[model samples]
Structure formats: C-alpha cells, structure tokens
Target: METVMNRIVSPQAWKDLADRLGVDEACLKAVAEVESSGGGFMRPPSQLPKVLFEGHVFHRQTQGRFDASHPELSYPHWDRSKYSGSVAGEWKRLDAACALDRGAAFASASWGAFQIMGFNFAMCGFDDIEAFVAAHKQSAEAQLAAFSSFIRRPGLLDALRNKDWKGFAAAYNGLGFAKNSYDTKLATAYLRFGGRSP
Candidate 1:
C-alpha cells in the first residue's frame, strides 16, 4: 500500500468530494486543511494517518475476548495518561492495542485525513473495518470518499454546505470540539480557502 503522507490532493479530488457531499469546493478544502493539513498525513517517515487511540474504546471493543490472566490482551493495566499529543506515543499505544485484538485496535483509532473512527466503517461506506483500512492505504482520493460517506451517513453534510462550523464541528468533532477550537479553526480555514467567512 502506498503511504498516505505523500499523496497529493488534486483539484479533481476536491471537486469530486464536493460533488459527492453536495457542498462547495472550498468547504471540502477547508476541512481537508484542518483535519490533515490538506494531505491526510501526520509527520513524515511513517506516512501513516494521524491517529489517537482511545484506550477506553479499545477496552470496550475488545471486552470479553480475552482472559484477565493475559495482561497484554486486557486493557486494565493500560495507562491512558502515558499517551500524549505526539504521534509516536499514539503509535506505541496503538501497537499494544493491536496485540490484544486487531479489529478492536483498528476500530479504536481514527484514520486518514478525515480522522474518522474505524468503528465507523459501515457508516463510511466500507463493508468492514479491514476494508476501511485498505481504502485508507490506497490514496487521498479514497480517504476523501470515506469522509464524504461519513458526513452523509450522519446527515452532517448540510452543516458543512451551509458553512455552519459550530454544527459541523459538534457533529463531526464531538461535544468537546470547542476545547480544540475545531469550529473556529475550520471557519478560519474556510476563509483562507476562498469560502465566505461565517
């Protein structure tokens, strides 16, 4: 699979995503910029999608699959505080999570430029989690396809199309979206990408 980091966002990719989501090109471009710096990658070298592993989610997803004696397979000893804002730290935690269960591990982390959770594979038009990961490894085009599908499934496309950053962020970025200022940042990015200021 090609590394997502080096993939370029062609004009047609934006146009396609906008068309699929029934939104303006600028809206798609702004989200792309804010989510993955317009390229769907974290830092260089790894070229993997930026991911934050939710240990709680991992435990919930993998519960009852393994015995307590298998400490590595259990989440009880996992220290969420050990993982911070760095991608490297997140990767380490992700590796440990994968050891417990690959499906649950992948489902616990958000993927690609859109940062959609793996648990949302079905909502994102993927047949399953494995399929979602395969698409993510393909290219930015695939990632945008997943993003568009995710927004449509949750009926969040309207918020984006109307430039309702707060509504969009609330639905897309979760309730704590304000703490990250995702709404404001997206608004700023929209203006930068030629969208009308909101």
Candidate 2:
C-alpha cells in the first residue's frame, strides 16, 4: 500500500558503511540477508517496508492499558501466535494498533531491513517515530545507516565483527533468538557471504 519503496542500495555503499562500522562488508551483508532476506520491502502491490509488530512492546508502550481490551494487539508477554506471519499482515496489526494508540503503535513495531524497533529511534539517531519511519520510507540507505548506528549504540558492532554469532543473536534478536536459530542462521549466512571466521 506504500508508494515509496523504490530503494536500491549500491555495493559501494555497503562497502563504505562496512568500512565506517569497522566490520567486513560481508558481515553487514550477512546480517541484512538473514534479517529480511536481503530486501527492505515486501513484494509488489504492497511494497511497504518490512516490519514486525511486537504486541508485547505495544503493551509496554501503552502501559498495558489495552492488554485486556485488545489482547490481539497488546499483550503483557511475547507470543509468537499473535503474529500475522507475513509482511503485509504485520502492517494490518500495526494499523489496528495505531487506531488504539498511534504513538504506542509506531513504537511497538520493528521497522525495515535490520528490523530495528521503533522504540529505538533515539538509539538509531532519530528524535521520534515519525522521523524514524520517514527515514525508512526515504531509502534503503537510510535503513542501513540506522542499522549501523543502532549496532554501535548497543555495542553490538564488536560482536558482529568478531563473528560472535551467539552473542550477537542474543543481543540483537532478544530472548527468543535461540528458539529461531538466529545465531546459526547468521553464522551460515556470514560464511556464505565470504566472511572469514574470527
């Protein structure tokens, strides 16, 4: 449903960002690949940037006020079943949550390729969710830049550079990371991207 999804980042941009992040280009590529299948938007027709709504996050953002009335969109705990299981479906969830609480809704979802949470706008160098989402709509380069800034804020860059897949996954993906095998997937993708073992 989005009209602005014409984003194509060049290989040079990736390399340059990697250089600035002090990590191999392949390392960055691997995270991108594993994060959103190497693309920042869904397929045609609804090229909205990729996102995953977190009901638990919404609950926290709104202080659990809507948890009982809108358990589907706001829950006290993380529940995988709450997911719509597709890029478009996530937007639907976000839209519904937005109707209840716009700011909380925006802050509850992870946005773009790196899947950075909207609550992390400050960490990603944005003053607010509107600016964060605007950057996501601008270009994939903005998304990549946000990812770079995000990792550095939490000091995940060293974990990524050193190939500490487990540590990186645990920190970046949260508690359910191991359940999804994110560490192994990241390692496999990193190696596939020609990242040397560290």
Best by lDDT: 2
Computed on alpha carbons, the lDDT of every model, listed in order, comes to 0.77, 0.86
Candidate 2 TM-score, true structure as reference = 0.93
lDDT of 2 at 88: 89
Candidate 1 backbone clash number: 0
Candidate 1 regions with alpha-carbon error over 4 angstroms: 1-6, 42-44, 64-82
Kindly list the per-residue Cα lDDT of model 2 for residues 128-194, writing each as its tens digit: 9999998987778889988878999444888888888888888898867999899999989988988
Full-model lDDT, candidate 1: 0.77
What TM-score, computed on C-alpha atoms, does each candidate reach? 0.84, 0.93
Give residue 186's lDDT in candidate 1 (0 to 100). 92
| Collision count of model 2 | 0
Indicate the worst ten consecutive residues by lDDT in candidate 2. 1-10
lDDT of 1 by residue, 1-198 (tens): 345334666787788777766798988888878876776656656656667777656767877455354443345444556466687777777887787688998998888777888999999898999999888866777888888778884448888888888999999878889988999999899888888754
